[model samples]
Target: MGRKAKHVLLTGGLVSGLGKGSVLAGIGRSLQDRGIVVNVIKIDPYLNEDAGGMSPAEHGEVFVLEGGEEVDQDFGVYERELELILSGKNNITTGKMWKRIREKERRGDYGGRTVQYFPDFVNEIEEWLSSVSQTTMTRKGIQPADVCLIELGGGLSSYEIDIYLEAFGRLRSKYGKENFLHIHLDVLVDVLGQFKTLPIQDSINRLKRKQLTPDLLLYRHKNEINSGAKVKLSETCMVENLFDIPFLENKEQLCGFLSKSGVVECISEQLKLELKSEKGLVAEWKRLHRLAPEPGKVVRIGIVAKYNINHDAYLSLTKAICDCARSLRYSVEITIIDAEQLEEGLEAAIAKLLIADGILVAGGFGVRGVNGKIMACKHAREKRIPYLGICLGMQVVVIEAARNLLGLYDATSTEFDPETANKIILKTENSKENQGGGSMCLGAKKSEILLEDSLAKKIYKNSFVIERHRHRYEMNVEYAEALKEKGVVVTMVDEKTRMPSFVEVRGHPFMVGTQSHPEFTSSIFTPSPIYCEFLKAALENKKCKTSMGLNTTNE
Candidate 1:
């Protein structure tokens, strides 16, 4: 309820990866637990609307919010811990700003005044950030939030991130130091069994160059922080309120440390705002909980994807699955299988699929794991196991059907093979060639659900619903007839774009593939329509196990 927002900007020192996002989310979660309405802003240094076009192997998977924001994965942690849904305004990146500035120019909003970098570009970015902060608070039915967490993406000394640095400098003056809390995530390396403190010093030097010093120096390491190591880190970093927190590599202690260290309380006191806990909200949410199935039966979901190798990539999905499982009162176990690890002849893989209560090929990019996912889909279709494919997973299902069921051996996504003979999944016509940063379906776009008494319809038990999307390629309409002929039902089409959006298998207990990333739209209390149905199918499988007298185990 202050004129100036309580701002916390997290910036990394030295190299890029230092778990700034984790720290920010941890603090937000701790404060929200105290009943504070937290709004997070993720400002990526890269020039992109979102991180959608980036490779999952290089940058990790783009974590989408319930409102369909293709944002940095840290937002996933924030939403999961705080148990709140963030709108599209929660994320910002260089590409998003440039596009906005260009649009303003095109609309003649500048009134014939030519825009320049300093006051023009920087000012626009600042305005955008403030607007997002205000708008999100207004939408949440709370007074302007007691605190706003902002993450400056990449690192402090990033040459490419100069605009963000300058913008923050101006913002610091606007809010004054009293309302601002700066935290730096510093990484220390171990060279020849001795922990070298050079990285921490060099990191602090760069932050000093921006005329900003951290209120807290977070030494990121794996295990416990030793006294010698702490002294060495403090000597190098030399911050007033230095604290040692574990890296996100081990995320268990993240929330606890933030709460115990008084980081949330410190910020609230500095910002002169009352700290509110979300415990009441969480308890209220718990009160409305619908129990899952009895412990007699269990459902096992095989989530096949490239990012499965790292649990962080699927954070939001894991939360949603847990929520869905709780809703049905069914004991659910999710096994993450690396799609790229599939072997030839697939008999062993098929055996794994048969044991699963349902098969889910999750969203990812590249050809590295394509054939393996396609193989899983083929096995699911053959064995009649409940199957659910999302985003890139849906493309895999469509590609599999195009090749085996429809006899198109060359079916492929243009992202994998631009010159493939059967480009069953083509890039949007408006997409530019060779743009990696943001040239993709970046925001929340709706698709219509047309039910036909199919599995998808039975799961939703309704028609005409909207879900969020973040994908560049979609199934080619030319292959729609062929797929339908093979009993692969094209249940839903893009209402506005008239594109092929969703497909379901005929007579299958539950088999639905959507071009959109359904994981982005799922929440702790409210599951997306797609995931709700997937859980329903998973529950059915668990009931079958219960009928077989198999006791459920919650592992």
Candidate 2:
């Protein structure tokens, strides 16, 4: 806290979703690899308190922090790139800031003074950044960040984000420009097979209008950016620090790409930091990637989701599986089986689910696709195929076991069917936790998982562990006695609530479910214990099929 943390601002112009998050994380990783204690922050300029309730179809994925905060999907990229467990405090939002202001106003903490935007809002952002800077998140421990990397959500033209621009400008003035570096990212659109430069010039002008200019310009393109286009942007538009960012297959590849472009060296010099390469993060990343097994050994995974059409809805869920598979040296061919599609009929659902080497039903909402997910769980249970369920998916596993094994046919979740007498999965009686999304969330400090000699223990390698959660319904205890008597046991439990958080079926090939979400915590360097073990089972299933003369894949 003694030294002020250096700030690197990353803002996108022309449009959002240009992979600006990747660039920000790439820069952070490049510095962290060089022995700098860095912290990354993501500021979302939205009205929603948090990203928990946003539609996957619209907002892509809702990334849950270890603290149980549901943030934008970019945080997933940040965690993976930075290789650090960031707190929900790292994710700032307009809704969060305004909510605090309104709360203080209602409590008469503001002293009834009519608050204006300029000093008030800017002061709020600055204070938030100061706290974040003082306590940087790292794998080793919490400490003051040497450099703080912030990814400003939305675009330069976004009206909601104009306040951030003004606040950043004011920050530059207060602290001196030497303490801050601005990276403006833009994409070169391929219009009729020709790369455009005029739009890039316009974005620069827009930045100038906001009284902020880019020190480093990170640009994305469909193909290699033409040299002429680059010259025009640099000479004419006065964009001196231009860096070309290309499409890379792996998320970690971004830092290496920028390193080869000499972008890392340029940044360190501009920031005036001692350029010392420590363990070589880029080198280690590329080394691991080069050793990945070929796609010859494929693991077919079927993900049952209500929003199957939107892959981003389950971005972390899918990424966890993919990352785990890569760690075990296997390729994954994911099939998004719509839960609603599975509801047409049990037979229809089975036919669709037959394509999976391992079946996974991720978290979801409502009664709309509840039956389909149950059918998928049933198929996996009966066929003895490796299966993993999460959140709503976990509830479906419990429901399936009750109906088939315990003979409770009317068993259902209160969330899906309130009228059902046998509610296997229902909302908590007294406590209030969204299971895993929304404005308020349980922090990482509270979540606990107590494991036994089950698969959960094998994967986690600990009798007690911590993970994330995102669900309204939990595993009910009313039917727990009978279910446990039938070899369906709750392996891991919420330490405080004593609620069943993780479930595993005995005598099954590989059946596991957890009320908490493991996908949210899985990282490229260390895969989520649950996901890693789940994929390992699928790999074994693949090997078993190959040994018998059965096709390894349904396709």
Candidate 3:
């Protein structure tokens, strides 16, 4: 039989949002650099199948996997840092687990025995973890290496968290101490001008009482931990691998610090795994880090979205802009404008949009703030400011052009108004049949650029491209000719359905929209072409302003 897989369980102690996800991603990347095949799993305690239905303000961005599974935003960090493709299995929510258990119970998998939380529910979770580990071991034809890194959601004191820890204890006993290592992350805050460690001490005490002793204690602090504090932590916690991690300013610094830190060595030693030289990985990371753009000019781009309350809702979009700025050697400042507020009055929204070198309309569901998005698009068009729209944003752009430019004031998406005569945007046939399930188009699809001189075509420099999509409505093909005659250019179409995938204003400087999401594929190493072009246009606009001696400040 093959050797048992090694497990690294990471849990938060003192508080939430203690950079646990970032630390986990860093550790996973470090291990991978040492030729270790690592799989990362996040156990969210939320009672949702996934994060898709949750509001971004409550839970941040819902990262859509290539498999179309919507997961927490940490999956984005994991994918970016580790450079690995994760799936639905990588994310396990409380709702998903319970659903599976209930289904199995209905199928009589327990053989009429009374189903209980312990020994039944707990065993199910253990089995699920084992299955995920085994599947990940041989994923993508890689050599079978049993090293799984699991991150528990929320703090240790929650009722749901206690249940998870109980299962974790059972797994540790079953797999042996050598196969399982627990790393606890706690925060050190400044109190009375001194870095207090009592909160962490109390947290560790709570864990000990629950029979879960941490092998490593990671201290998150705003500033450096003094020698006295470090000694005190060691003496109190009795953890040899005590790490003090200060909040980093940027990804480059974080990667460099993690690579040099001895955290990876301690973990590898505890798991009894041989470490390989990371010289190549270190050089690659340095090269990426050096790609950071110089600080000089600031190109402000306003992103108008309904979920502006939480900037993380558009994390991928914002990150893509940052990546593009780095590649172009241009600095960018992103401002989130609330679309709901814009609906109250365009005066304030226009003021915000005027300050931006470029404007972006982000994707979202429902009709709450859609009119505001349309108004923002109109402002971008009339002002000739660079504009980029995504998904629902694309739909609104078409609607705006149809109404204002095409002289069809009644033009609106059927999604917003089912009774509107000009149904420029119509629901997909499947969506019409089933109002709830499998209606929306999801996942990756291929597209072909139809217009040679369009902005999208120039950005991609390819006649054909593949991008991920998540939307239910599409531009009506019957109005395609009408829209084109009205100065709206169709740049791309789906290779299979021939649906309009990209559109742009004919004479505008950079007004463009995409039915598919380009942000999902954007990464630190490779910025999406559309975003690269958009930022380039914004930089040019900024330069143009400077050349004209125009005041650049928003005020």
How much is the lDDT of residue 160 in candidate 1?
81
Candidate order by lDDT, decreasing, is 3, 2, 1
Candidate 3: C-alpha lDDT: 0.82
The segments of candidate 2 whose C-alpha lies over 4 angstroms from its true place after superposition are: 107-112, 294-296, 345-352, 430-453, 552-555
TM-score of each: 0.78, 0.93, 0.94
For each predicted model, how many residue pairs clash, with residues at least 3 apart or on different chains? 15, 6, 0
- Candidate 3: lDDT of 151? 95
Superposition TM-score, candidate 2 onto the true structure? 0.93
lDDT of 1 by residue, 443-553 (tens): 566566666676656656666656667777888888888788888878887777878778988867777898876666565556666777787777676566557764242
User: What's the distance in Å from true for residue 33, model 2?
Assistant: 1.7
lDDT of 2 by residue, 8-49 (tens): 888887678788887777777778777777888889998888
> Alpha-carbon error at 455 in model 2, in Å?
2.6
User: What is candidate 3's lDDT per residue for 1-555, written digit by digit as tens?
Assistant: 776568999999855788788888878777888888888889998787877777877778877777777788888888766777778888988898899989999999989998888888788888888877753522255455558899998986677777788888777778876789999999887886688878889888877776678888888888766788888888888777888778888666676787778888988888898898774665576576567566655789999998866767888889888877877877888988878878888677667766888889999888999988998899888867789999998998899989987888998888889899989999875565644323567777889988787787788898899888878899998888888998898889999888899999888889999998888878767789999888878877777766767545322
Reference-based lDDT, each prediction: 0.72, 0.79, 0.82
